[model samples]
Target: MGDSHTSHTGVRFELLGPLRALRDGVEIPLGPPKQRAVLAVLLLQEGRPMSYDGLVEAVWGGSPPVHVRNLVQKYVSGLRRALGDGPLLEWTGSGYRLSGAAVDDLRERRQLVDAALAARDAGELRRAAELVARAEELWRGEFAEGLAAPCLAAERLRWSEKRLSVLEARLAGQIEAGRPFESVHELVRLAAAHPLRERPVELLMLALCRAGRGTEALLAYEELRRRLAEALGTDPGPALRSLHARILRQDPALLAEPVPVG
Candidate 1:
């Protein structure tokens, strides 16, 4: 959790989708929701010690039970019993610390993304795309999903945005690598799914223009413009505006061979 260990064996903690713990590839049954919530908070901290008050604030938000500390201790104890009291989780004087032996899905996903970027920088386009695909596969669902605790829900949103960024990067890479037409269909779905995310729409417009469908590209911009006005009471930002302007001018630059993005 703190740093990359050479061995990704041992215990694995999955916080990307659901709160799950696996030892040697076998799922370990973590206790009830509260106990799993405690583990979720610890897992998010990534080896940093979480104090009692911090755990309560995260798990219970503004309305913790009367004997919250005792309940916390009880949950921790239950977790220990369920996990066989291994040194993976420990009390570090003031608070609980999860050891680095646990291979977290979040950390693994970041590593994959970094590798993908490295592959792109080296011009190994196929390898880079494969790495990105692998990274995308790591997410089974939302972060710490199906957990109702306030803290877990917050993490779910944070990771959701990050995953979207990863997907956007993949689309951008393919689009800039002279595969604009191929990118159009995927970008259409992505833009629709996240209507306010202008980046996907930007890519969609570029792809449309590259495919010699200038009119359709212009219509795409209009649709986004209207959607923004209808939803947020705002117009597209300068980036989208400038792209729209270029498409209107039938910018020759749009016809130029695409450059691969790093």
Candidate 2:
């Protein structure tokens, strides 16, 4: 089903996984790479639209063929066919726009997660978790994996990193809400998966410490320190350092009762 809003103009693309496009609960295949690339650029610039020239640059770098503009129009026609009669494209004086929703999947998810985190910080933890959970569910893998487009690479990394940060926020909220020692194992796995991310390491330490595994918490810190030095030639940053200081001082905050689950 479509969202609370009306119509199929509000299509969402889940490029993080296998480039799944959905219009009103129906899967819309975006066709071959060049075609998908055109649609991807359009979706990424929803509402604002892109000129034919701009899209040519996005899809074909600087040296598009003489027929490139017509090719782009054809691809847009194909996208419209797949996406239904919604206003997927609106011809502007200079360009075309993807009308409504103003979302690529990652952008939509970012908005959702950010809103949730804001709510959670304002003492609406349950609402926050719900939003973040929905956002995280949208990620299947790296964004647009097979595309070698230079512009999209930076965008992919930016979106992926934002998703990771929001996920960490959700986990931190879970820890605060007394989800249980089960989080410890997950934190450990996260630390292993992303050895360079100090937040997960610190979270793992906190989880162990709160579970009365202070020795293991310190050990976790040592392991992270070693890994950081060996892998990145650097130490944990200020946040991790502060966490270490808290552990050493045996700050009572470490022992404080978990926040009540909302």
Candidate 3:
């Protein structure tokens, strides 16, 4: 592993959106989509060497053009020129590896999320919320947007799910800290965006109820129930239903601080 300052001086790869490279705070132009895809594979693998065959499969899936190895070499050479001096892209046996410390936005976001969870577990609610919000800010949009490579699908999905999980965890923490009103607008937008996801709707309902808008909370539940039934021929889950019942009975427990969702 390289020193933190050395890593900071090297090339930093961004794959959270379109593939981009930056060194000393200036953007480095990665050639075309295919070239970017190749770099993306290597970066996603960290410093692990990817064999020639593996690179081909990742870049082109099942059908690769003739003389694909030469084409891949071309891309690698282009990347080397674009990367300049700091980090080294080295050929290992029949494979290639990107060496030197590189910062990945996705990895950084995950680290922030992990830190937020640790803080929350340690009863540092305010610090946890701030960290999770910072993590959420790292996403510009979908991961590898405009890159149509099959090799990136799994990682993209994993990052997307983790982002949502972090967002929900943040909301839950806010609600538990008697800050439900603070997350109302965000919870509403999230519920509207993902009508079928019960968790956001549940959070929205809880937030509304906590804010003394119990009627609106019931309305949100009704809308979610109708949407779920119409779209998936199913009703809201038991937890939500029980919550609805609690709200209807004006359970004083609703006003009490609740446990954070894991």
TM-score of each: 0.90, 0.81, 0.92
lDDT of each: 0.80, 0.73, 0.82
Ten residues in sequence with the least summed lDDT for candidate 2 = 1-10
Please give, for residues 1-262, the per-residue lDDT of candidate 3 as tens digits: 1112225547666766777677656678988888888888888777889998898888788999888888998999998988888777999896899887455676676788789889988989989999988877767678877777778876788877777877898998999888888989999998888779999988888999989999999999999999999999999999899999999999997889574577
The TM-score of predicted model 3 comes to 0.92
Better of 1 and 3 by lDDT: 3
lDDT of 1 by residue, 1-262 (tens): 3223222445667776787777766678988888899888887786789888888999999899999989988988888787774536788889888765454676778898999999888877678777888888877777887787888888778878888888888877776667788888998999999988788888888888888888998898999999999999999999789889988998798678454342
Q: What ranges in model 3 sit over 4 Å off? A: 1-9
- The better-scoring model by TM-score among 1 and 3 is 3
Give the top-scoring candidate (TM-score).
3
- Write one digit per residue (lDDT tens) for candidate 2, span 36-116: 777667767856868877877777887777888788878888877877756556678789787764445656676886799
Task: Point to the candidate with the largest lDDT.
Answer: 3
- Candidate 3 residue pairs in backbone clash: none
Taking the candidates one at a time, how many backbone clashes does each contain? 0, 0, 0
